[model samples]
Target chain A: MIRLEDIWRTFVMGDQSLHALQAVTETFAAGEHVAIIGPSGSGKSTLLNILGCLDKPTRGQYFFDGRAIESLDPDELAQLRLNEIGFIFQAFHLVPRLDATANIELPMTLAGVARKERSERARAALESVGLGDRAGHRPAELSGGQKQRVAIARAISMQPRLLLADEPTGNLDTHSGEQILDLLDGLNQEGITLAVVTHDPEVARRAQRVLEMRDGEIVRRISADEVSDANPIFDRGRVGKRP
Target chain B: MKPEDTFGYAVNALIQQPRRAGLSLLGVVIGVVAVIFLTALGEGARLYVTEQFQTLGTDVIVVIPGKTETTGMMPGFTGTPNDLTLDDAEALLRRIPEAILIAPISMGNDTVSYQNKSRQVVVLGSTPAFFELRGIPIARGSGLPEGDIDRGANVAVLGKETAEELFAEENPVGKSIRIGEWRIRVIGVNGPRGTHLGQNLDLVTIVPVATGMRMFNRTSLFRIMIELRPGSDIEAVKEKIEAVILDRHNEVDVTCMTPDAVIESLSAIVGTLTLVLVGIAAISLSVAGIGIMNVMLVAVSERRAEIGLLKAIGATHRQVLLVFLMESLLISTTGALVGLGIGFATIHVVTWMYPAMPAEAPIWAVFSVLALSVVAGVFFGVLPARRAMRLDPIIALSSKG
Candidate 1:
């Protein structure tokens, strides 16, 4: 489970402080599948980064499993990310120098896993993502969707309780993008909580819950029961019209 | 991560960048080879001088007339006011029982002629003790007979090479040779004594001291050579001889030198020369260190994405720093090992070229060079690794430049 209380993120350029995320609050229980949808600069990625423990909130607090993250040191935060949270970046941030299996094994290597066990678990992780045949391919050699799968395997190799995906299908074709979403949906049904940020409404259509962000704040929320009545894509079309 | 794992990673990265690693290695190898070969040259010169003096005799002392000043004023080939004589040498021989053999020397350059063959050679005049003190043995015929000091025999002894040149294959014993104008009969031919301190030992002729003084028209001996009894306290003998000479002459114009002093001074000079040469060689090692640092900094910049990925995977700032440092250690450690082999091979080549040069590097010098290379690697490794450690994961991950 995750909880955010008045979270804020500010960036200072020159003498000006830009509020990237402002006074955001939310909670998601275990096994809840959610999607954050908005146009560019809506603070959706910033909120997901805060949830993943990758970036600290500039104001207020975030709690994961009843533990406040703002009070933790850098080493403690790193431990939390290692064991409890997994992040899937829009860019599929797999190490270019490593093969698919080695890329998946990196998180466990940092966790002090034995070499033999790391290899075995890395192979299993690759198989789970339907990338077993591509274990020896580097990111440069892999297709975009294959690379994204390896990145996914790497993220979940440690069996984190929560997965935060930031525009996970942003760089893929429609077909592979569908495949990636199907894989993530299966992981969520298996009891791992998932949070996906996306501009594509089709990807948002399958979420159990949806949150719409604009101007550094969450402006709308649609639960599973009300999902069919609300069209988030139609809302984005209305916002672009001139008065 | 385990240390073995860290090392394995480091080795893998170095293998990926072979040209960069090899260029750094070249710097260290050149430095080490220079140090080994130059220092061995210095040691070889020291050993050569020590061996030459030892072969002469440890208890041998040579007393020359006139003081050798610390300034640029050396005792030249001119006669001194308080000249050393045969009587002064005899006085020291009589007083010190340790003085087992004393020979008075008179030397000059002359043209010795035989029928149609003539050559210019060094003519040395001394008693029979000269052969014992100078380590020369006669091959045939008798040496200078006893009691010849006062009688001044007109007998001549030819050096091996000199005898061969003037007589061809003929026997020179009992044969007469003309030295300037005086006719002397060859009494003996010295066996080959090779070369010492670059002077050919077998190109000289010898005669009795009294005859030499008459031939050169000089009364004072050029130098007095004394052979002390084996195991004699040379310092005590030197003091006693100086005291007797000072009493007879009443001046400190005389300089006495023992073989020990020569050897000690020679070693000191060689030691300093070796250090200076080794220091010059160390500059290359410093250059190598700087090269490693430059390459590592570029590596950090080029691999920023990889660094970001590792940090995301749970690597700490310290682990990132250690990885870069370990990479440098691998480079330098490999360089040092290869450099040592290069140095050793160079020494062998030098010894092979100059068989008698006696070049051998000290074990400590070899160990120190290896240690120096590793230290250079780690020392210069710090700056780049620190830069990598301080990098922000967010900025690094997003940076396309």
Candidate 2:
């Protein structure tokens, strides 16, 4: 569960105070699949960063599982992020030196998991993402699709409640993008809350709810039923598969 | 993290960049080896000289007539020289209960001749106690008797080598040798005493002090050597002897030196020389430290992204600092060990080459060099490690350079 009340985030650029996020208020219940859809400079990534505890709003009250994150120290925030938040970046951000398995096991290792347990858990995570056979391959050796899968496996390795994917499919081919979206949808179906930040309308259509933004403020909120009818692409998915 | 785990990581990291690590360690190795080898050579030389002095009777004290000054324009060596006559030796024997034996020595270099052999040799004039003080055992003939010294008899004691050179396996005792114009009878041959302080002890010939004074036309001055009573404090006896000499010579300038004082002075001079040598060697260590620093800085720059990644993965700032610091420490410590090995090897090689010259490495030198290497590592490594640790992770992870 996550809540933000009247969040305001500003950045000082030379003489001007630029508003990255302004007077935004939002909430998401557990197991909800949501998408924050906006064009470039729409503050979607900044909102995702705040949700993932990588950054904080200048003026806001943030509550995660009933704890006030706004008052937490940097260390405490970092610990919370380490334990409860998983991020899938557009660039994948896998350590180049580590293989897929090591990359996936990194967060658990940081959490001080025993080596044997970490290996077992990392193996299972890889297998779930259909990358068990490629565990020994480094990111440089992996394709764009395979690297994203590795990133997804790493994100869920800790089984964190919230998964934040920023443009998860932005760098992938169409087919790879579809496979990545399917993976996220499957994870969302397993009762894990998912929030995706994307500028792609097709990506935004995959979520149950979409919050469209302009400038630094949310312009509109569309329910899945309304968006599915409004966008023809969602109708094609409904025709081909059971929702 | 546990210390063992940290150490394991450090070792693994060092192993990963073997060339860099080896290069870094080479600096320390050279430093340590230089320290050990140089120090060992110095210590060995000191020991050899000290042993040479020790062979010359530990109980003996020599009083020379001279004034050693620290500055100029004052009393030079020409100051009223202490008149240490043969009577002073008699007075010390009669008054000082600590005096076991007294010998007055007068030495001169003169050409000596035998049948057809002629060579210049040092002629020593002293009492019979000179043989006991020098630890020379007569090989074939008897040493000077008390009667020989009292009567100023022309009896000579030929050194073993000198005898072999001059007499060529012929009987030296009962033969006569010419010193300048005086013909002295070879009454005895000294045992082989080897070289003491570069001087061949056995090569010198000894006769009576009175004979030497008569031959050289020198008077009222002689080097008085006194051996103290067994179990007696030499320093106390020396002070008492100095008082007696000063009273006899009316406190005129003179130099009196005990064996302990001589050894102490020698050790002080050796220690100063060692310090100067170590100071010079330290320049090499500084160059080595700078080499380590340069290598670490390059490593830090190259690993910037990895450092950022580690930090992002929850490695604390201190942990990042420690990783770099440990890398430097490993390099320096390895170098120091290599240097120490080289140093010991050098000493061993030197000893093997020159069996007569002692070459021993002191334990303290080894430890001190090791300690210095660690200090150099930490001192030179901290800057680069701090620079690496302070890098902004977000920016670092995003950096393309």
Candidate 3:
């Protein structure tokens, strides 16, 4: 479970201070799948970054599994991220030179898991993502879809309590994107809490609930069925599935 | 993380960019090679010079006229107070029971002629003990006969080259050569003796000290060489010789020097010269360190995305810094090893090519070079590693690598 109380993230540019997120309060329950939908610069990514512990809120109290995040030192925060959170990026963020298995084993390696266990877990994670045959293939050799799958494999390899995906399907073709979405939905079904930030309403449709953000504020919280009717941004043909 | 894991990652990172890693390490390689090769040369020269000094017996002490100043100015710069003569040499033998044999040397350049052939050569004047003291062997006939050094002998010992030049194919032992006004009979020919300290030993003609003193028309002897008995304390004997010279001349005007002292001073001078050369070579290692720094800085900037990714995967600041630091340390260590290999191989080739050059790197220099290279790599690595470690993950992750 996660809770954010009145989080504020501000960025100072020379003489001007810009508020990216203001008084944003939200939470996600255990084993729940939620989507945050917004246009560019709407603070969805910023909120996701804060939730992932990649960045700190300028002002807020954040609780992850009943532990206050703001009080943690840098190393403790790193440990927290290592043990409790898994992240997937739109660009797939796979180290280009490492094969699929090695990429999956990276986080565990950083966590000081023994070599034999690391390889075993890495192979198992790769199998879960249906990339068993691509274990030795580097990112450059994999399709965008396969790279995303590898990234997903890496995320779930640590068996985190929460998974955060930033536009997981943003760079993939429609068919592969659908497959990645299916894999993520399957992982969510297996009892890991999932939060996805996306512009695509189709992705938003897969989640149990949707949070619509605009102008650095969360304007509406709706169930998955209410996105098409209640949210106005997708009304302008942005809701249509990609060709 | 485990230290081996960190090591593995660093190795993998370097292996991923083989060309870049190789380029970064070249400076250290060259530095180490220069250090090893140049120090070997310096050490070899020192050894060669020391060996040359050792060829002269360590037990022999030479008394030269005039006192040498402590400032190392020319001897007798204050004044020419006394001339060391045969009498002073005999007095040293009488007063110091440690003296086993003494050779009073006198030298001059003059013309020697036998039949129609004539050549200018260095004519040395000394007792028969000169041959024994100098370790010269008689190849034919005999050395200067054991007789009174004060008595002028008409017999002469021709050097190997000097006899060959004057006699051609015929033996010159019984033949007589005219030196100015005196006809000196050749008693012996020295063996195949080579040059020492740039002096051509094989081109000199040896005669009795009194004969030389008469021929050069000089009243004072050139220098007196006293060979002490074995196991005799050289310093004690030197003091007694000085006392005898002082008693005879009324002033300590003679400079007493044992071959050990000369060899020691020479060894020290050469040793310092070797260190200076090594110092100059070590500067290259610093340059190599800077090269490592430059390459590491570039690597840090170029791999920002990877750094960010590592951080996102939960690498701490210390871990990130250590990874980068490991990279540089690996570069320098690998470079040092390659350099040492190349240096030793090249030295081997050099010694093979010229057997006379006893080229060998001193053990301390080899160890120092290894330590220096590692230090250079790690020292230069810190700045870039810190930069990489301190990078903001958000900014770094978003930047195009």
lDDT of 2 by residue, B264-356 (tens): 878998899889768956777778888889988988887776676555545556777887888788788888888887888888888899888
Task: Indicate the worst ten consecutive residues by lDDT in candidate 1 chain B.
Answer: B70-79
- TM-score per prediction, in order, is 0.88, 0.83, 0.92
**Sort by TM-score, best first: what order?**
3, 1, 2
Q: In model 2, where do residues sit more than 4 Å from their true spots?
A: A28-37, A48-53, A70-78, A87-243, B49-59, B69-80, B110-123, B148-151, B167-171, B178-182, B211-222, B277-283
lDDT of each: 0.82, 0.78, 0.86
lDDT per residue as tens, model 1, A1-243: 788999988888889887878899999999999998876777887787778666788998898988999888878877887888887876788877678988898888777889999999999999999988998998899998998899999989999989988778888999999999999999999999999988777778889989988878898898645544355443432111111
When candidate 2 is compared with the true two-chain complex, its DockQ is: 0.17
RMSD of 3: 3.6
Highest-scoring model, TM-score: 3
What would the per-residue lDDT of candidate 3 be over residues B242-317, giving only the tens digit for each residue?
7887788898887887777777877888778877877776688888888889988998999888898889878899
Scanning candidate 1 chain A in windows of ten residues, the lowest lDDT window is A234-243
Q: Which ranges of candidate 1 are over 4 A from the true structure? A: A51-54, A224-243, B69-81, B106-115, B118-121, B178-182, B209-222
